[model samples]
Target chain A: MSLILKAFPLGFLINHDLSEEENVSRDLRFERENLCLIKIATNLRLEDVNYLMENLGIPYKYKNDNYFLNNGLCVHWESYQGHYSVFISANEKTLFEKTKRYVDLIKQGELLFKNFDIMLKRNTRDVNSKEIFYYCYKTNFRTRLDVLEALKKHQMENILSNTENEIRFKYNNKNYKFKRNNKKEMFYIELEQKISLVNIGSGKKSLIVKNLKTNYTNMDALLKTLTERGAFSVHSDKYNIYCEMSGMQFLFSRNNTRGQYFLSVDRVSDEELCTNILKELDEEYGLNIQDIVYKKIMERIKDKNMRIESEEVQDDNSIVLTIDLG
Target chain B: MGKLKIKLLPDGTIEMETKGIKGKKCLDYAKVLEQLADAKTEKISKTDEYYQNSYLELDESQHLSDN
Candidate 1:
């Protein structure tokens, strides 16, 4: 029998502590309150991520399935969703304090957490995308004719005469089409790529671009994507009418087979933008501006409500809320 | 029939507009929807509907009652 003398790699074993080392493969496990913890305003490397997680004295696992972070704050990283978001449960208000500490550490000397509510964009593509500004409003247009009349009254400039049956528009190299799905609801799809063009007045290269398409090619997939991405939908409807004018768009929707009248302005970025656009739209259509419906609907909906038409976060940049009065 | 319209914007703004109806009657039926959505009364436009005193809505000569 040959005896082999071997020195144990004690240092290697000590340094690679299984508990301390990040389980980059383990599916993260944590109860998400949908509350953001720390916003990584800038790009960071894996080492920096490790350093931050270690100093926080939290058990965090970031891998393929999920990113679970726990520092007595229930922190989790939302990286797979296009942007990197660190979400923490605001339970017992511990998230606020932890967020403050995180911001302080990241800033070191610069401004951080200026508006913690904003959730500033990072590479987190799923949420921070500025592409699709999906929004809806509660309108009282009884029929398609009523909507057309309002559009004309509001001076929707250069609208297509609709000599053709299919809804189509061409601006620059981009072509947008509206097609009815099996559910009979309209889906906006992009049919072309890019082409540079001269602005009629300035002769400058310009693209009259509007981001309207969701990640999916079909409406059903889009609904699924939205739900998985944590979008809240309120209600469902039977029929819908859509139109576009200049930088603005409209969707008149209904739940019943007969006249349903809800008006929504498409593509405005925020509440202030929506308000300002509403002002211009009101002036054109003889409207008296009152309140935003999302807040009201949110208030009316119980937290446990699971209606898909009620609300959806179109992206990190936009939240689309739908409330079917029917 | 006169149309009582409730305009709900994405930013959580709601506007009520009545067409072919004059006086406060334009807002009468709208109140029900307003309450259902839990919306607050922000800016009310008279649309010549408030000042005419007469309930009849004339097609010509639009008048603004308030900003």
Candidate 2:
């Protein structure tokens, strides 16, 4: 009986309708004051943010967790995340413009891609047409590696000087010399020739010259017999007779030095295919370039008198850092 | 003293906040941090604190001679 309880505040009870509108306005303002929203480019990691803060000479205290952002601002930083509603004051908008510009500049430097040389370094070979034709002989669509293995398995006994860079052998009373360039995967056969008499019509003999061409035909027939058991297909384009096999084009052209024809296998590079492969790499592991940016940022921050409060890995593999700028 | 809090998600996105700093100085700080982080600022909304003024201090000394 001595204590009186009021169900509502005195002002709210006095001005019910006006107070209702005011209360709504005040609630909205409170929400706006508590939260600031930001969306950053996706793929930025915790360490990256820390590095950036350090470069900016901002210090923070550390706490590691995946807790939701409750104060100041919440960032929609992950690319996979959807959009969020944000409210910004007019004066504070200017501050963001500068930040936006810096973000663009940093992204320009960090998001770099690897070129052909770096992408295909391991698969690259110093290709020479003459060299490839000699050692990497192929029939139909079989691979160069397959043909080479077959030759090795069948002709191991006939090999005269078989080393890392050279494989010289005598087969069918004819010498075959295959040499690989030093520090190169390409192999070349030194020019060798054999001349003989061939029977012509009406009891007569004609003088004929044979070189790599004859051996090429013989080897072609032999490998075809062993593998596909089919005839070799030939293609010609004006000055050269060629055979396309497993990303390689073997061409037989006249060699003026020996007055004979020699085989030359050139690699047919598919630009579109290479481009697709590089694109795939960029899509799969492209974010690695950000590491360079992080490193550069850390470099700028080093010895800058900023203090790191805490650093940790969250359940989602994200990193959190707090720094204090004293 | 000024403070910064940073979060890096596994997907390579960065979340950052500045505390105990206000006004245009915060903007400058944001710009520098974004540049160092190599991230683009897609969206930015200022909190109430961003509209508040920051503090400044000056150090000075006075000397007097006695006869």
Candidate 3:
């Protein structure tokens, strides 16, 4: 009965609304096996099974060590000495009816599909072997043929349409799925590749110095100071600029908040350069504070109509401003 | 006469000392300087002179007593 039932040519089951099939006979089945059959069973991998179970939200029932779909369509796996084969077996009557209707619709111009070159020939050695015409349905997926041609031109391999809005392809040893919404015309690609880690060995602590704050909130002022001190920018990007000072290379990165910049010494282990930069920056900030306070004091004195009796500079570079109250 | 001695340090610290301003008046100037510099005051030490009254205030009190 199984051998006779296997002779029937049935395509893979595609899930769709069966509102037009409300009047079809439900008890119809193959004469010999009394079970609806699917000949082109889809050979699936673990990820494909996951995509069916998780992404498509298809419910399955486990029975007799095999997973059965909504209507007794079994998805079973077989193992032989550590090698595993997984495939879907269709046994539902409704699904077989839909497949038959779909084939008829394609033939009658109500539906559309491209005729594949390879004819599905079941058992050529048997006297009852017949050539069955199988069609690759275009309704399941929609994409411009030019877009597929362009993808092929760019060396994208194994491009397959899995659903209405999804196209899975492989490029640069990475698998990705491109999905598009026909209504909104918006699309995005999801990466379906495994991440591999590269080991970066350590023990070169003095080579890379990171996150050294210059305490200047303004990046322009900081760069100006560095430029004035004979450091020239060698390379620059959006966030970081590499500079060289006195034959040593360093990086200035805007990795901090509020327009602040950080200095990272790259590949140079000279502690003196770091100390010198800190000293110069310190002096610059101190001078800036001194100027601001001096201006503020002078403005206050002018507003109060006070007289400056004496202005002196001490040996330690301290400024003394004597104000006389009138 | 009031003297403001400001030392700009190499470590980005500002040291300010107010002389001849007595009776907490120097604290006002300290606050003003800190605000103008946009810096936080790490330490403040008040000398004995900060507690002393100004010569003008002392003279005014003496003159009021004579009157």
Docking class of 2: acceptable
Candidate 2 or 1, higher DockQ: 2
lDDT of 1 by residue, A239-305 (tens): 5445433223445455544332455654432334335544554342321211234454456545424
Judge candidate 2 at residue A263 and give its lDDT. Answer: 51
DockQ of 3: 0.25
Candidate 2 has an lDDT of 0.37
Question: Looking at candidate 3, what is the lDDT of residue A32?
Answer: 17
Considering chain A alone, report the TM-score of candidate 3 relative to the true chain A: 0.28
Candidate 2 residue lDDT tens string, A102-161: 122112111110111223232111121121111111012122343245345445246655
Model 2: residues with Cα > 4 Å off, grouped in runs: A1-287, B9-13, B38-42, B52-67
Q: Residues A246-270, candidate 3: write the lDDT tens digits.
A: 3346677775444556777654434
What i-RMS does every model get?
9.8, 3.1, 3.4
lDDT of 3 by residue, B1-67 (tens): 6766665543346677777778668888777556645566779988877756655677888999999
User: For candidate 2 chain A, which ten residues in a row score worst on lDDT?
Assistant: A1-10
Minimum summed lDDT over a 10-residue window in model 2 chain B is located at: B55-64
Tens digits of per-residue lDDT, candidate 1, B1-67, equal: 4544444543334555555666667566456455656444656667786567444443232444331
